[model samples]
Target: MKRRKYPKANKMMLVSLGIMTALSLPIQAEEEIFQLDETVVTATRTEQKVKETPASVEVITRKDIETMGAERVVTALKLALNLNLSEASMVGNQVSLRGMNTNQTLILIDGRRMAGEDAGSTANVYELDRVNINNVERIEIVRGPVSSLYGSEALGGVINIIMRKPEKPQSTIGLSTGSKQQNASYHLDLGKQGKWAWTFDTLFTDIQKQRRSETTNMYGPRQFYNISGTYDLAEGKNIDVFYERMSEHLKTTDYTDDGGREYFTNTRNSYGLTYRGRTTRGNYELRTYYNELEKNTDQLEGPGSYSDFDRANYKTWAIDGKNTMRLQDDHVLTFGGEYRTSEYRGTRLEDNGDAVSTVTEHGISKSISEKSVDYQAVYVQDEWKLSDKLLLIPSLRYDDSNRFEDSLSPKLGMTYHFADNFRLKTNFGKGFKAPSISELYMKMTRRPIPTRTVIVIGNPDLKPEKSTSYDISLEGEKGAAFGKLTYFDNDVTDLIGTETTRAGSVSTSKYVNIDKARIKGVELEAGRHLSNNFTVKTAYTFLDAKNAKTGEFLQDRAKNRYSVQLHYDDAQRTGISSILWYEWVRDYRYKDDEDKDTDYNYGTLNFTINKKWNERYSTYFGVDNILDKKIDELVLEGRLWRVGMNYTF
Candidate 1:
């Protein structure tokens, strides 16, 4: 691995920080100040003001999304401080928060979980990308351990996407075209004040293939579709249903005349139903969901000779229920339970000189080509307002799985309002992730040639990975200026890895739990509204992540990262608004499969302008990665421009 210097970029970042800090100071002492009253529901399963929540949380409102001109959920997520996005050759993009692996973070839509792992124990972060940004009301991010409430995969934190509900009868249509993609969307609402209120939304997108160097499409063509509807049964009661589908086609070819070619196709379908209600004494919700994913690949040698065919299928079903009650004036109790099941099936066939034969099958046995697992969990939490200036929240959860040992997770948090506009908070939580079905039952063998054989086997005796996290923070707001500083540390044990063994000409690989890790970091966030038309926001993060046993730096974890944005609006007085954003990520170290290390850095600038024609129409234009910064290994395309219009009636 090699390291490069970027002194010019570093200087610019420092100057920008100084200017923002200076501008925020003058607005703090103004007599009339704007206060933020944003509310969020992911932190506690109940709605509460952002400032009153006991945990560290960040929110991206609907207005913010529109102002930023983000076309995908991943684009919006990257704006958050301390979060890292990586592009994988097969998985599209993977997201990591606070130096944790992608699998350690949990993703949710309307508080419902989605599938994370495949039959090969590989995490697919791109699953969240299927969501339509037009249907989103807002995004809430909680930046600490939440395993006590959500069960597994919460060691890093949680990202919850909330959908919009209509309050009046209206319809909206949107269309956009870009240098690399095209998009269209439609939404409608009817009978908002009646007992039979309903809302509908849909989106379609098409992305063209991107080339690398002179040839080879790094990213293939992709198409997506999503539909959702909600019906109101009565006051404080409703039922909602949603369905989404996507198809992708990819092709890659070698430059040589006798080179091989590969074609891949992927299709996914997901749907869910939710019922929720509220009463004088309590509130409750019930939800159920089903998801299916299929992948197919074909390989061809020179000209049109068949080489191989591979296919895989994954299915999941889940049901969950939750209830909240006000037991006393100072105590609010919440209870939840969930059941989930998943299955995986896969097969591979290779071509011989005379015929094609089955080469690999993934499952427990030949008779049972599909491997399945079931999981159950129950959790309870209490939010106690001990005093006017003090608050405490305690939570506990127990989980049972058919293939792993039973486990328990607990968390405790406290907040003290020491001053009129200031608060101190601290939290401690235990987190764990059970072994996936692929890590416990998958079996496969491959024979590339006549004398070489490769075998891969799962380890049913592997232990679950566990972590203990601690965080403390100081938050305050004075007039139009607000800021927060936080420090966090996490200790993990029994981390999973692969071990390889070789005997003569045969090679074998197996999964093992034999690693430990420790990660610590500091985060600082500050923002201010200078006036009715001008605003500034900034965030910075410093992380120290390493292997606990070997004392080596962790791979793919950046040491420094920051983001800054400047926004101006005329309050619709002038019918024009604009925003400028910049992000910097310091060089990070990563180890390749061949035992080589590399360091990389990226800096990008984005700007958007909006023009309002009237109350019923608006147009927007934006440029992404204006500086054209490139990372060859990440397959990032540079300098994209887009324009779009929205209509409402």
Candidate 2:
């Protein structure tokens, strides 16, 4: 027999943990060097203060959201972080974080995962307005690896949309109308100290149809309605819930009639609930969610008329738990777990006079499919202050599921404060994602040319995708000036995307696992208060992503992006504050375009002004794409403007 050695990631972690404990013997003090003041953070499993954490975090307050006129979460995120928003050739919106697919980026509403759409394998930002901003307190974003805290889909980073709580007993209403569209929202917040508290909000949006460059109808009218509320259970406990629905009606080109009857509709529904509690030792939370979607097209053709329809519905449920403790003088430990399951049902039908004589009959055939996935993970993290200015954070997680092979992920990071206003930080982590149900099982039927073709497949033996990510950030914060710069690199294996095959004259495609890819980028942001009445914010991002297996540039990664904002405020007199802003993005890739260098250079300038008549009311106006320049995308409109008001009593 021969002796063998195995790499001990856990042993290394324990050694670091022990050393941290030994060094903290003499540093225990009752006095807080940093005020443990309450600050909300959903970046971690626990709602901890931002200053006490060992990770880089950014918070977007509700006040800031209103000032920036952020009606959609994506717009709020775009203003907060330098992310790339790309349009899909087929149908949908794709957002990239740190040059990774939008699916790789995880988004949460009040700490629960937001479900993906059926139109494509992507999250729908189109329905963001359904989330009433009047009930949002703030948003937290962690721009780097968070899989050590969150299980999967947090490969690139995490975005948490935290809703507001009713801190007082009050009510408010608002209305607005503007170019091409308008919206109205109302809020009612009632609470009685620690016994019971509740907050309710309602929002409605009716957007006018849009036209193409040729003055022909391109996009149809859209309407949305939402109602949500939260109730406090008891001291250190609470329950929150919400419901949302959106609808779009369009006279589309695909549904044209000689008799002048046209029809097309898209609708979505989403709702969820969350319960939370905090103890002297740690904190705990639980959440559950559901979403549904349906789309239809109906019409009567000229002489040779035909009808078709497509429908899709999605459903999901999830549970997550986390806890944190100050185990020792120098070591803070965090532990948590998560589970999620999703199902999809869809169909496409056409009337060819086989079962129905006329094209006016409902043509949705009986095509039903179902898929489900289960994920369970447990993670533990330790934060050790090695010295007065040196700190180390190491974490490990085990993820097991019925869908793929189990995996163990390890992460290590350090932060060294060398100056009062400067610090150096670095982190490396391993992350993985279970195959999405959509990728594992999808069926399609096609009839082309002379004959018909049918394809049905599910890769039950598929493997989980994995990635290794590393990043370093330099940050500085002073009285009125602050700046941050981060550089990160990601190596992904077993990437999932569509693979196409040809059969006779028909070509069919399905999602499959591929070799590998690499994404690298740098992000910079700076802000300064020049004077008592003047302030400025600016940001820049440079990305270089490629397919390591093919040595080709990755699709849809912009090489350059920049944004600038100037603000002025007067606490006295007019009670008005205004901002002038501009943004520039250099073109990158589109899935439909064969040319790799389809570069585009475009910029936009916009302005917003908010005036408070008194403590009870405020009015504001905003105009986007001020020059009305054409920015082409598959599902997005050209340019638009909005005006609104807020009142409280």
Candidate 3:
């Protein structure tokens, strides 16, 4: 690995340390103290406090989201430690966790999986934009392999979003405007005990295009809508349904002398239903869902003398069921099964003056082409309490797919209390990811001109990527302070890579299984609540990732990252509250077009102040990137000011 000199990085670290010291100095005078014991459910199928969970889990509460003034789910996720964001053309932004690529992370809503692939083999991070932040109760992140619970796509970790359940009648309306965007949202909850319950939520957002010298955005307007409902059938039985829709339209101006234009449009729809009940044995849930996505692009050049069009569509349907049982006082069991099917279709057309042709890969051209795949899986897990201070959990899963071979994954975890307020935890798990639809059957062509041609083909014989992960941690608490230190290692086999072959003048690229890769990292998180109204929190992460076969460092992974935040609530002592946050991301390396390492780094500061005028209304004002720190190519918008008001009835 190569190192680059960054003078600012050291300064940023010192700044954070200085702030912590300053805050601690004033704590000795304060007598009141408070501790946090946040509840989380993603680590296991059942709910438990973050401190009790065997795995390292992070929880982002609704109050945290509101204090940060985050308008979208992606914005809130960016604040998490060790998570990196990357930009992908046409497919929006992607996220990498624990030095693993985007595809290795699995995202879920209410314990159900989301679609894992896009039209061009890109990961589906953009789909997160559809989730209404105002309706979310909380988000739980488990940062390690959980394939024993989830089937595939859990090599990196899992993010589960839990929606709020309406218990009483209430309503809220909010509107916010910023330097680059505008948003409005409405939420209504109406219900009566033992009868029926319903919840309605909707949000609308608009973003303006931005352009700078040598750096411009081709993206355009976007909109999202979500609706959900629930009904109670009996004393312990209920049904829930939800629907979401998203769309975007974009146009880009040509930078060349030809003065060409490119138009692109993308739309997605998702809906699902779930039936839940509590029986004498335990609790059970059954769910079914469907999702569809469509993308289209049109290009015009040289005063309409040349034209081209491309279109792609993807759809998926799934059914899942799970049951939890209590066999004894100290033993609990959970089992689940799932069935899913997915389909993909794409078409391309080219027109040049006297001739019109359809572009294709491997001389197989058609107006429209289609492919489909199906999967079935079952899993079981058990939690055993060996004694008052020791606990053990074991999980296993089996999956069978029409497009690939069968797979089996297993995991074991243990937790032991070493002292009054300290515990030791360890986990070992196996994970796997099946080849995506686009990677297995996609047929696309690039640069269809006669002067130069490049074709991309999909290999149906590609094997599934697999991994083994191990981690151990020590966590404890004293008085009003809590801290945790963790170390983890993940080794992956049968890695997927793209191979290009050229015959004569035609070049072809296809997906294949490669050798081995490994990632090792250490994390430290500490926080202290000096008083009931004042608190401080910080985290640091160090990662080392490489390809074991080639001995080359992985691309686009930061070796060191850290975050610090200071918060004050006042507990309505003065009817005013404020929060100050500072974050610094260490320099990371990436391979440019010429395969040379390039370094990128930056830091940001944000502050928000809130005032509750009365019981009916409250207002907040905030400034993001107060120092105006930015990397033009990486950041979409910089140094923004926003104000918003919320009305409750």
lDDT of each: 0.76, 0.65, 0.76
Superposing every Cα of model 2 onto the true structure, what RMSD results?
10.9
lDDT of 3 by residue, 116-153 (tens): 35433467557566577778888888988888888778
TM-score per candidate, in order?
A: 0.90, 0.82, 0.90
User: Can you write out model 1's per-residue Cα lDDT over 1-649, one digit (the tens) per residue?
Assistant: 4667777767866875675476457543575565568888888887778887888888998777776666777766657767777665445566677888777877887777655355333564665666778888899999888989998878888889887776578998989878656778887866455455566777777665555543355246556555566677788998877776777777666554366667778787889998999998789999999888787767665577655566667788999999999999889999999999976666521120112234442222212255667989999999899998998999999998987888899999898999998999999999987777667665656654448787667778888889999899998877778788899999999887778899988998887897899999999888887788887888888899989999988887778778788888877833878888887777576666587767667877989887878888888888888998877665557887788888999
Report the error of model 1 at residue 314, Å.
1.6
Model 3, residue 473: what's the lDDT? 96
Error of 3 at 420 (Å): 1.9
Model 2 Cα lDDT, one tens digit per residue, 141-258:
7766677777677777777778776678888887877764466777877765565566767666564544433222424555555555566688888787777666777653432334
Clash pairs for candidate 2:
none
Provide the lowest-lDDT 10-residue window in model 3.
Answer: 348-357
State candidate 3's TM-score.
0.90
Number of clashing residue pairs in every model?
Answer: 1, 0, 0
